[model samples]
Target: MEVVFERVEGRRYRVGVRRSGRHDTGPDVPPRVGVGAPVGDVPHDLVHLAIEEALGLRLGIFGQVAAGGDLGGFFTPPPADRSPLRDKRRSQRLARAGRSDTGLSESLAACVGHDGRLRGADELLTPAELGRVQRRLTALVDAWRATPPGGELVVTWPEHLTVRRGVLPSD
Candidate 1:
């Protein structure tokens, strides 16, 4: 599976954890779940963080579905027909994207130079420190389940999903 991104509206964005396969590129591309906010120029670090976190959760969900007694003896494999080597490569990409230390933060701060108020995750990471950003993201996901019913915030799973075949780029 690959991480695909789409814009809902304005800064609101949705990133899909799509299994490879299928060519319908319209609004109905791969079955994707929304994560974080929609964005136009998302910083490199946030994109990586969102993809890694979302993929990890989706994999867990797949495992659960396969293990459910309803599946019976049927077994489901991991996404993308990925071998262990391919999986490692994908992981490395995510790690690289998510890498943000104090230095990047300092540089980003100088660039922005108090130009505007921070929005979304930016409010919490003006310096773009990875550890701080990761902690904030954990808090957000924890609250995902606690969002009140019918609230603007919601976390849901599709009725069903199938992972298809596709080539994931090393970059």
Candidate 2:
């Protein structure tokens, strides 16, 4: 999977996740999944969950991010050009939140109910399941924060973006 985080405007960003190995031979090709939102809209605790869903990670009984131990990597910066506009916008958002804008990437994730489908960077989960995911993600974020300043956050993908499972929560 290749996740592209594009700066839309201000602190808003558009995240597109595409399956690798697919040829974009035509103009009608579409990404496997996509999501977008401003940094402050979603609760920080749920960001990883949102990214997993946007990347089609929870279609199975177990999501890949939960299965894998590299959730901290998602906080890594994308391998994209950083424009002055994006930097300034991100800095402004961080400053408003009383956090240092320098050498930090502000990220937020949440799930939105759209057309009877959950969208954005979160998965639909039961209260118990949500709590479990929250704890896991919080630990990951803490590790990410502990990384040396100027270190990059890189999001790596599993060979398959989605897997099949016999059982998962319907709600």
Candidate 3:
């Protein structure tokens, strides 16, 4: 899946995701998933991506999406057919939310969501991991900054980190 962040205006951005093959949708989820909102220092989801990817939190928000699971309402699903069975299947797939890293990524992203850098998150990440996430965020934010209005920064969800049944975090 490719995550595209488009700059709509100063401090405003929209995120559109395109997954290979048919998009996963259900009774409550749309065929397409995306969001548009005001941005602070950097895009909120971008922070989630940076922290989760750097820390290998595969069952976090992006991982859920990559595996075609609706992440509650954090990401907006635009259009699609609704099926009760599909929704139930999606729920089963997302059951991995019980993993600590899932919530850990959400909490960690909040720490740097708007500020675009890590702050006081040492407990969640070791010193080495924190440094890595910070560095990765800096690079991602830079790319987003350099993108002109109407332009987009597209990133691929790492294939190895994508959530899969029978494969999950040790925790």
Q: Among these predicted structures, which one has the highest lDDT?
A: 3
lDDT of 1 at 11: 41
> What are the models' TM-scores?
0.23, 0.30, 0.76
Which regions of candidate 1 are displaced past 4 Å?
1-77, 101-169
Query: How do the residues 52-137 of candidate 2 rate in per-residue lDDT, one tens digit apiece?
Result: 44334432211322221112232223235544454334333323332321112122232422111223323345555445545545
Candidate 2 residue pairs that clash: 50-121, 50-122, 76-153, 76-154, 77-153
lDDT computed for candidate 3? 0.68
lDDT of 3 by residue, 63-168 (tens): 7777656663534443455555654466555755635766887678767746577887978878999999999899899998899998889877777877554453
Q: Residue-wise lDDT of candidate 1 within 1-171, one digit each (tens)?
A: 333344344344444333332431112123233443222234232333332243332222222221121111112233454355554454444334323422333333233212122234444343445344355445544453334433333222222322122322342
Best by TM-score: 3
Better of 2 and 3 by lDDT: 3
CA displacement after TM-score superposition, residue 113 of candidate 1 (Å): 24
lDDT per model vs. reference: 0.32, 0.33, 0.68
Model 3 misplaced regions, further than 4 Å = 21-39, 72-84, 95-99, 113-115, 165-171
- Candidate 2 RMSD to the real structure: 16.1
